[model samples]
Target: MLGIFGSARKTAAAMADTAYWQLIIDGVTSRLGPAEALCLPARGPSRNMWNWHSKRLHPYLPSLQEEFRRLAAYQAREAGYADPGQTRSMTAPGRGQFVVGDGAVPASPVRGPGSKTKSKKKHAREKKEPGSAESDGGSAATGGESPKVAEDEPQANPRRKDPGAGWHVEGGEEEDGGHRVFGPKFVLTSVRDDRPLSRIVLDVRYQRPGKGYGGEAALAVSMLMDAAARLPGLTGACWDGALREIHRDQLMKAGLLIVSPQHDGIAPRRIALVTGCPCGNRHDLWSKGGALREAESLDTGEIHLTPTTGSRLEPCGGRRHRWYLLTRLSCGNTHRERLDTTREDHRRGLNRTEHLRQHPPDTDSYIHCYRWRPDAESLNAQLDATLWNRRMIAYGAPQQTLVMLALAQNALTRHLHHRQAPSTTRQERAPP
Candidate 1:
């Protein structure tokens, strides 16, 4: 028994030494490529344990297989097989079982521990019946019944194209061509008074052209007409020169007076003329030039004559002289002379020079005036108040609001000067 143990130990030591040497050779080959002659270290656990009797041989077999696998992998890598560990099955030498090169053994196929005839008989019994569905055809047996059809197949409805159909179809053309007519709904509310004083509600339907309004002038005219129609007590509304030519007849028919500041004609009577003024530098005032000089009366041909200045004043060509009078009324402060020129030598050169010096009669800063129309002046004052109120609310600042208030007060004071009736009355009690 001792001799047998010693022999086993010697075999294990030889196998370990062989595996250790093979490992060192594989490492050297990896760095230096394959070579004919290889030298391995003489000192190692395997070499030292050669005389040791207690060493076992079973443990060394795994190390030997591992070294062989490393050598195989190195060879596979050099041969350009990217995956060195990939397996190819091979029949073990003189054995039914197979051995994997990377240290794996093939598993034996499972079989029943019975005679060949008995195994054949068992498999035959487990087989399906000859006339069953599996043997007859690939189709499964369903008691010979046919399959039912689905219900969602395409079908035509007579009213599919009709927009009034109860069901909504996406991307379908509407029956009314998807056109909407919006009635007048906007109301002008004054923020200062916190009241909606005027509203223009149109019963008419306006269509947006597939092509939009081409210019700002058209849009402004549309917005102005729309706004004016809603306001109460608005006898007439006027538009700028850009809109006058295009919408003249239409605006006049609608009871609106179209006045163009750029036009070289006077606006018709009772129609509010909106024209550019040299004084205001805006197209807000009734007209350009002088209103009084433009006015005509049945009793008096021209209400007021244009003061002859640099040249002979033309007949005004029947243009309404209202604008000239309005200009005088607007510039009443500057025109201090009374209407009666006989009592007061209104043609005094010094007075004219002083007037010209103080308020220059230049095109840029010319003074405009209007005949004192109580109703119109009152309405203008209200409009001014409303405008100031809007500015105050829009600012929403206490200081700005106070400033607007002060401005409104000043405007109201000036407006009162033109009023036929003063808001305050001065009376003295007799000898009180």
Candidate 2:
């Protein structure tokens, strides 16, 4: 086990897997050395013990995840980072920053207990249509030590029935051509409020992505929603093109706006009537640099957004949810355009699962926080530094979450390193 994880000066605490990390006040250092914050101490409980507790601790997963979020929020608050009204750029909205999020599937693939020890697609069925295992339970926000699964559960034919571990087919489409993964998958969401290296975790389901059960778009919305409570005065978001008019409308309902890229899908951007004053110049909606500066109305000067579509019943939403977002002109003197937020025309079909996005392609808001959106690649790199093969060293999502929250404690220590990084520059500039 030591060789697999490489040797670390590990502490003799193997039974510390089931406690809320925010409550652990002992053996914690007040300051983290840079060397310590960047590396993972290779300490893992036995596989059987981890798997058993993963099952036992599944019910308490949500609160435990919440505890970890509070821990990160506490670190950010202590370092003076949870403010939405800070400034770092000449173009960023001086008002605040947005909660950025993204999802990833690593090289870590899982196999059924009955299958061979090989990791290939031949044994794993290629799911053309969507159908994945239902989430047994448990959610992990950030990347964690994806522990090994030996399926050591004591059951009759345990190989045939593993809880929560299942097959998930991602991109095989021509657009993304993503990957096919089977095992416990996670979205690994993040929230950074005006500070750098802030890995504030958002709750993401660790279920397989198929049957449209697991998509990062839903996770992105939930991540922003979660960050809203923790980081006050969050003004807007800049995500990949996964967001739509409905998502933008929802965020607007929450007093927020998203300047994310628009993807030309089965439906097009909102159509505008040419019966207006400045309706001559129409910008291509899907290009990277297609957006123009928002224009004010020739009449009122506040905002020129006017409703063009009608309200309708929201899909899958019971009597409660409705699609009130209609085609509205881009306000100000910039002219007229709509977001086609109401999927009024289901041309071909709603390609709701095509992933990849950025802030409205080439607009100013897109450039404002291009680096803010924490995508899968960055999180996967972090895991690569921590675990071998960039995979979780834990089994089920709950257990993987414990590993994640435990690692999230590193954020506190890492903040110390970030705090002292500029003191050297200060010394260099100080006149003796």
**lDDT at position 101, candidate 1:** 8
CA lDDT, every prediction?
Answer: 0.27, 0.46
| Residue 146 lDDT, candidate 2, scale 0-100 | 30
Residues forming the 10-long window of minimal summed lDDT in candidate 1: 96-105
Stretch of 10 with least lDDT, candidate 2: 3-12
Candidate number with greatest TM-score: 2
Task: Kindly list the per-residue Cα lDDT of model 2 for residues 1-432, writing each as its tens digit.
Answer: 222231121211323343422223222322444454335333435555544655677788898877766665554444455465664332365323455555544333245444444333322333323343312222244344333434333323433333445555454334566555545556665545444454555445454545474266666677676666676745556666666645655654454546555555533322323444365554322211333222235555653333222212112243222222222344323332332233643464432222212233554556666656544356546655665445555555566555555544244445443566576532212111
Taking the tens digit of each residue's C-alpha lDDT, what string does model 1 give over 166-216?
111111124523322211111111101111221111111111222255333
Model 2: lDDT equals: 0.46
lDDT of 1 at 209: 25
Predictions: Cα RMSD each: 46.2, 15.4
**Global CA lDDT computed for model 1:** 0.27
